[model samples]
Target: MDAKLLEILVCPVCKGLLHLDKARQELICRGDRLAFAIKDGIPVMLESEARELPADEEVGQ
Candidate 1:
């Protein structure tokens, strides 16, 4: 993901900062516990389309 784009992207639900998981191609919102998918270098920021994080998952940089 582009650094410029990642800087501006936030969680749709809580407007919180997102951590870009480049290897997984997902933008993770810890506050909302959601993972927004990034497909073909484009982030899919829709809340309805976000996937819920697994309860056992640990999120952060």
Candidate 2:
């Protein structure tokens, strides 16, 4: 993901800042407990496209 893009990216549902999960290729929204996937180098920011984060999932600091 582009640095500038990541800096501006936010959760579609809650308008919260996102954390890039490089290993999973997803942008994590802690406030919303969602993970927006990065497909073909572009973020899928739609709420319908997001995956619900599991309780056991670990988010980056």
RMSD of each: 0.8, 0.8
lDDT of 1 by residue, 1-61 (tens): 8999899988889999999887789999998899999998999999999999989988867
Against the hidden reference, what TM-scores do the models get? 0.92, 0.93
Alpha-carbon runs more than 4 Å astray in model 2: none
Error of 1 at 26 (Å): 0.2
- Local accuracy of candidate 2 as per-residue lDDT tens digits, 1-61: 9999999888889899999999999999999899999999999999998999889987776
Query: Against the correct fold, how does model 2 do in TM-score?
Result: 0.93
Measure candidate 1: CA RMSD.
Answer: 0.8
Give the local distance difference test score of model 1.
0.92
Worst 10 residues of 1 by lDDT: 52-61
